[model samples]
Target: MSTNTVAGVRPAAEPTASQGAAAAFRGAVAAEWTKLFSVPSTWWTMLAGLVVMAASALQLAIYAANDNTNDDPLDDRGIVTVGSVVIDSVELTQYAVLALGLLAITAEFTSGTIRTTLQCTPARGRVLLAKAVVAGAVTFALGLLLGGVGALVARPTLGGWGSAPAAGTIGDIVAVATYLALVGVLALGLGAALRSAVLTITVLFAILMIVPLSLMEPDIAVLNRIADVFPGVAGGHFMAGDTEPYPGAVGLLLLAGWAGAALLLGRAALRRRDA
Candidate 1:
């Protein structure tokens, strides 16, 4: 079978079905990228997140400056964890990305833009995956910038304090970028599944914030154990570099599991439901 014939004939095997499908998937990704940035809200959300990061770093610096009693070795521990301040800013950054992820799909549904989206990309799974990819990429970049600038701005806060964060701690801080991206993907999945901005955002916030609070209030042995492994708690270890029950890898895997499960549920919802 000749792929290219010289005898004025259409190519017998120009591309396989899988190749066509791959091309369609790529097109969906491109469409999602365009749609994501085309809206003004996306830029505003990212800018607000950066502002939060900067303000948070500055706030921590002010607090450190106010601590005028640290002329001892043991006391330096108080300021050496300045990196923790960077991690704190992740909360605001994560929330911003989560909103971006949720709105990426839910806004489409709310404004009835989803119908047009479905018309263009009939494969619902591709649409969802594309949204996830776009959301993940944007958040990863945002998180890196946030983490870097956060550390730089807070470095002065740790001046004349304990030794600098070691290489491993630096790696963990960098891992915060991946953690943020995963959080965004998780929100994107929830958005796809719920298709309502208010409900989706509420549920996400509850999962990330309220559920742990409720679980901790009981203080039961089993409940406390469960709370320790909750996505938010486990995920924090990634950036905070806290190693009590497990290492950073465990934190990353736990958070990644959260994101994977959400995306699967979202895909199922998109496939089973009508737009």
Candidate 2:
């Protein structure tokens, strides 16, 4: 045991494995956050997404208002389904979050910053995990803002069509935000594994939209059952927040499972593949 003299106390004890891992994760998060904010594309994408959401919401509200005869207020029959009117908007705009997630990781590779990033965090899994956290957080925040504002703006018109959600407006809005976060994180994991922007985005799109639709054949019960587990389908069901093919709890769990498995796969690929 080497001990320092000259009025110097013994060196600080080394951290345990768990402590070391926690510290590393924190550092990785800070680094990834810096990288994420430095990019101009993120700002552009978020701006574009918000613009689309606002436009669509206004259009829906206007259409609803015009449809009424002699300015009679609409009932709660059509406007309120599966929770809040905002939920429909939240679910429809899910693709934006998925794209944001893919870009969070794939952009690094596209810009050749991935090498530098891996060098900073040699533990590839830590890098992927940090990206997931950052991306998921960003999507959640965006979801809240979009869903809350869109819902509020359109609520009066939508209210005529249906009653307020039993779950409360705030709860439904927050649930949509959480669902966006989960979907975003899953896309981040797929980005890490694919390491290509185009491929990751296409695959995510297919999983979220095309696959389930294509598999829906009136005669094929088994195909529909298989589609039930896809992260997008499961998450979409949850967003409906009402009667669904799968229970709400099961839908959430399935979405979580997809994100976790994809993250693990990404970690494995990051470790094994050349940067």
Top-TM-score candidate index: 1
Q: To one decimal, what is the Cα RMSD in angstroms of model 1 from the true structure?
A: 2.9
TM-scores for every predicted model: 0.88, 0.86
Give lDDT tens digits, candidate 1, residues 161-239. Answer: 4234667446646777888899899999998999998899899888887898799898897887787777787788766
lDDT for position 31 in model 1: 94
Residue pairs clashing in model 2 are: 74-160, 75-160, 75-161, 76-161, 76-162, 77-161, 79-161
Q: What is the TM-score of candidate 2? A: 0.86
lDDT of each: 0.81, 0.78
lDDT of prediction 1: 0.81
All candidates: CA RMSD (Å): 2.9, 3.4
**For residues 1-275, what per-residue lDDT tens digits would candidate 2 score against the true structure?**
44564456676778999998999999999988887778787787777767766666666666654565344455422344323456666545777667888888888888888999888888887888888888888899998887777776776655555445646776777878888899899889899899998898888888877898888756488999888888877877776654567787788899999999989988888899888
What is the number of backbone collisions in each predicted candidate, taken in the order shown? 0, 7
